[model samples]
Target: MSEVLPQFRLLQPGTAEEAIAAKLASPSARVCAGGTDLMVAMRRGLVETDTLIDLAGIEEMTAIEVNADGLHIGAGVNLRRIAGSSLIAKDCPAVAQAALTVAGPTHREVATVGGNLCLDTRCLYYNQSDSWRKANDFCLKYRGDTCHVAPTGNRCRAAYSGDLAPALMVHRAEIEIAGPDGRRRVALQDFYREDGADHLALDPTEIVTGVHVPPSDIASAYAKLRIRSAIDFPLAGVAVACEITAASAHRFSIAVTGTNSRPVLFEAPDPLTGDDDPDVFFAGLNKLVQKSVSPQRTTTTAAHHRRLSVAALASRLARKLSAA
Candidate 1:
């Protein structure tokens, strides 16, 4: 007998209200914006949804608006637009920096912010096709009985590789979700549940509408470390946003991504204190980063390397932030 592909129902709505209704009516359905992450997951057979609700037609989901409150970027805006947006660069520089590191120009042009936030946590084992996974007895992230990367690990070992998330977290960004219950907003930090499969806390009946980034008066920057220059997920990434107080004082927020389950926020230290031979201060920062980056060897990179790189990347970001 010839094998048949799994059947699925499709719903494309022209407005946000229709999309919300369709989502609530079919709780098992999945949402797609740019389709970059979803398409890859479907090809790998990781997504079990039999129905897809495309949100691309929803007009409100693709418009960017700015106001006195802050900048509200539509969830469907592509990485290319986000990266090239002068407003985002001036107001949310960290986001622009992260967008620049997401992929090459092609991916940047098509991948949406919503897709990046909702990106499936990746694992070397889970990214393989079904046939390849079946041959290796599968892995915890997939249908396997064991975690190929960490045999003793009780949970899936996939890494949260999205570059945009940490930058948003550092900015205290909020995400708007539309559902049968209307709409609600939550801090982007709370959107993640710390589990690979259940990483997203979004309701099945909800569609991410947009992201609200609060205005910042100071300077910020983002740095990512990956095996390749472009189109590669980071082994480690850092976002630093700082504000200068009166009397030439400064306060900063440091966040890390691609090295843990979610963005790891660090307590900012005085970058000026270690001016003369900053080795002592760097040593302290390194120790703190080592404790902060709890990485698993789920992908090709080892846990040891990821942990060390966290400190290195943090140092680099600190220097950049200080200079800014």
Candidate 2:
């Protein structure tokens, strides 16, 4: 643990209802599932909560079950369990692969699926110790008025670098949120905002309770680019899901992440169909991805490198899908 953690009260709730009640009572409370991301933000002084509502004790939020409709994953379900779950592996290999790419083995064991989906957007200027940020004026993501990434912009330009989000977006997953207003279901694709400072559409009083992934017959794959194979966020990545019938491809959905404030879903130039040559498909995909993804200067990696990585990953995923 870092030495810069702020003082706060911890509340362990046995059920999601209790947790929501506690959060409503505190108003400024933050929810903690695995504390994988929350703890890091606290240590960096990016998050200062007066109370933390721990949801780990809620058994219902940790169950993984397959139902007649599809798979139901509790928000508290950890990444290691998702990666190892036979149900998820058989039904949604893209999601399983994305889960496997999060951090490393140790982090996967502690990071929950909900936590990953609700990950805080990252920026070079925002995620730092108080002393480090104080040396220079803070960014818009924090208390400062100016955004270091885009000084002319009024909103924060932090990047959403989570690997699982793009994969889940391809699946058309739905998020279940519980709060004082009652429960509501939101399409995962519509759950995120483009602004990094307020990334999730979730209200402050709400906490994600579970995720629902509908069953599908589509073939899918996830490819990520990072500085290292372990413990590093993706510099650029792509997730693809599509269906092929009678030697023609249909229902194509391609999502690109780690390059912008929100994951960008690429629209095919035209309906992609037929057993097209891998080279042809790759060329088309490369062009579309390169045009769609515009990497910012937030990370240490060069923007051009990130753009190239996205194109390369998309090409690889297209080849893999064609081969399948």
Candidate 3:
């Protein structure tokens, strides 16, 4: 059965300040960037809102710029632009590659960076038709009391399946937020919490204005495991950023998504270089990633499969970057 959207007033804000004020003024208001994810959840009766604060018209949040500080990408910037941006690709290939993996090209055309960064967590038990959910007594992420994925746990087990957050986190990106008081910035990794029912660290009236990434000499790449080549969220994803370090030192970074409530970062192991045996190195890498990810039965795939795939992806990415 086709679901219907709740009645809501759309408030178009021309600036970040206006958007923050609009959200603060309406008690039942929710912010909308690209509306790619929010609208779908709203239609499914997962989100109840009377007003939507649209940030499409805000110029400051829709532009990309490069200065001495580094690359500044507005939150409203679409995934399509980010995927195809030469500057972004050259500066941080992981970000562009991650953006390209989001859904499909058409969805990317309209999906904004902010939307991806703040994507709602997903769980098979949580995402369902109203009738289907009612029959199951709903879920912990919504109206129900128990999380079907982890009934014994108090918090939700919905997975954060976004691909971009991990890639950005590897670059040490910072998030710019506009609120009722003023604008503030925080590290991108700090923007998310482990609780899936309430993932983003943003307040009700706060808006993610943009992201700032400093330039680095490291080379990086991104890859994800999905059921389909297009239009599907990742089952597990990996982003690897590595630099050519001194012969005695092995230094790099790895970030993962789709297996937990929030994107996770891991420090690369020392001595994980050409000197080590390929089989031995990969075995250690696999063990580390598998342990790092806590995959639940949140999707159709088995949790073990997702965990294995994450380890494989991490090993593959590290090998590719090291060779490059």
Candidate 4:
């Protein structure tokens, strides 16, 4: 049987201020940009809200500008635009590459960058339709007492499955958020919590306004392990960004996603000195990545497989960065 989205009121706000006001009035109201994740959650009964504040009409949130500081991507800018942007490709290839891997062409046209960053965590047991969920009690993310993924667990173990977040984290992106009090910026890496139910570090009235990626002469790459080439969430993903000089790599940052409740970032203690043997450097990097993550059975893939996939991807990306 086909599932239908529950009835709800849609509120399209023309400005960021208006959107915040609407959310402040009704703290339970859900803020939607692309509606890609929200719509699916609504149909599955994973999220329920009487009102949805749409940010599509706000022109300020749709601009992509590259200035002296770096590239500034408005929260409402769609994935299609990001993937096809020549400036982004040259300035931050990892971001462009990551954006191109999100879902498929049609999904990218409607999915906004903010939506991808703020995507809801996923668990095999928590993402089923309403009817299927009812047969075996709801998970911790939905209001039930226990999490099916970890039966005796006290916290939700839904995996963070976004592709853009890890890429942005490697670039050291900062997120701009606006709320009733005022506006503030947070490092993208610090914006997510380990808890799946309350993953974002955002108040009910707050909305992400933009993402800022500072300019740097860095080489970056992104890789992922998924069930299919298109329309499937990644089983594991890795992104690497670093300044590669003739002798060594400096300011190296590696981020892993889709295998844990929250994305993990590993910054090298010091520059990887010496360029004689790239193979040896990548071998150590793979081990470091494998040790950094503690994977659980949150998705269809086995925990060990997810960990190994992340390690392999990290190695592949390291090789690319070394060559660049």
Most TM-score-accurate candidate: 3
* Candidate with better lDDT, 3 vs 4: 3
- Write down the TM-score for model 4: 0.96
C-alpha displacement of 94 in model 2, angstroms?
Answer: 0.9
- lDDT-based ranking, best first? 3, 4, 2, 1
The local lDDT score (0 to 100) that residue 280 gets in candidate 3 is 82
- Report the candidate with higher lDDT, 2 versus 3: 3
Residue 68, model 4, lDDT: 96
Worst 10 residues of 2 by lDDT: 267-276
For each candidate in turn, the TM-score is 0.92, 0.95, 0.97, 0.96
- Estimate, for each residue in 232-273, the C-alpha lDDT of model 4 and write its tens digit: 888888899887756655556899888777888987665676
Instruction: Write candidate 2's Cα lDDT for 1-324 as tens digits.
Output: 254778999999998889988977888899998898899889888888889988889999888888788888999999999889878877878889989989989988889988988998888887787878887777778888888878898987788988888888788889999888788888887888888888889888788999998888877889898899877898887898776755565546788888888887765655456655657767887888898876888888888999988888877776777667
Steric clashes per prediction: 1, 0, 0, 0
Select the stronger candidate by TM-score from 2 and 4: 4
Check candidate 1 and list the clashing pairs.
Answer: 80-108
Highest-lDDT candidate: 3
Q: For model 4, where is the 10-residue window of minimal lDDT?
A: 243-252
CA-lDDT, candidates in order = 0.79, 0.83, 0.89, 0.86
